[model samples]
Target: MAPAQYLLAVRRLRADETTPVPTGAIAAELDRSPAAATEMADRLAERGLVEHEPYEGVVLTEEGDERADRLARTYEILCRFCRDVLCIDDYEAEASALVGTVSADVAERLAEVLLTDEKAPSP
Candidate 1:
């Protein structure tokens, strides 16, 4: 859930061209209730992953940004694998890939394998 929220926050940052994203935007991105999003933000703040100010917004700490980048890449790799290799539909692939239990090493290896295989011709 933290990963998911981080992704959402990253996306919002990219789209809005801002540092701290409004809590409302985060809530909208996650399709979560505002209270839930605020609660999550507070938890992330406690963990030193984000800096949150009531009625102001939240921004990821440097460590949080790094984690979010890795998580996003892992998610993309998993989604590609599910869609291309497993032949799952896009929607299902997106949802199913949220089971991001793999370590960073595993995710990097999987991503490399997927890229290499993509360049290989169909046999």
Candidate 2:
């Protein structure tokens, strides 16, 4: 989850650009120490999910980008469910939803229901 979140953050920061994302930027986004962010980045790089260059920051590999996007969408869907269906607060919804795993198919179904249900809150 941490890796996916990091990738999503980097992807958001690099939207419409291919420039490498700075470690400091990632650390700031994740609210982690620079050293911790770098360590995680290194692990991701080892798995071929990202390319981490010392002092040059990191860039998500193709696989990482796709997974990150999926994770972000799943998170959004869960958050919406929590907010509209369960009446959870925004902050709690986001945090609570991510703490548990939700499969892509389940998330898609939830999103479909949210979109089609008359009583669902506006997206």
* Candidate 2 global CA lDDT score: 0.74
TM-scores of the candidates are: 0.77, 0.81
- Regions of candidate 1 where Cα sits further than 4 Å from its true position: 14-18, 91-100, 118-123
Native-structure RMSD, model 2: 3.4
Local distance difference test values of all predictions, in order: 0.66, 0.74
Q: 68-120, model 2: which lDDT tens digit per residue?
A: 77777777677777777777777444743372367777877877776566432
Best candidate, TM-score: 2
Q: Using alpha carbons, what is the TM-score of model 2?
A: 0.81
Over the stretch 1-123, how does candidate 1's per-residue lDDT look in tens digits? 545545545554654434678777788876678888888888888988778889987877777766776666666666666777778777444633463476667766776777566642211
Clashing pairs in 1: none
State in Å the error of residue 80, model 2: 1.2
User: How much is 116 displaced in model 2, in angstroms?
Assistant: 2.8
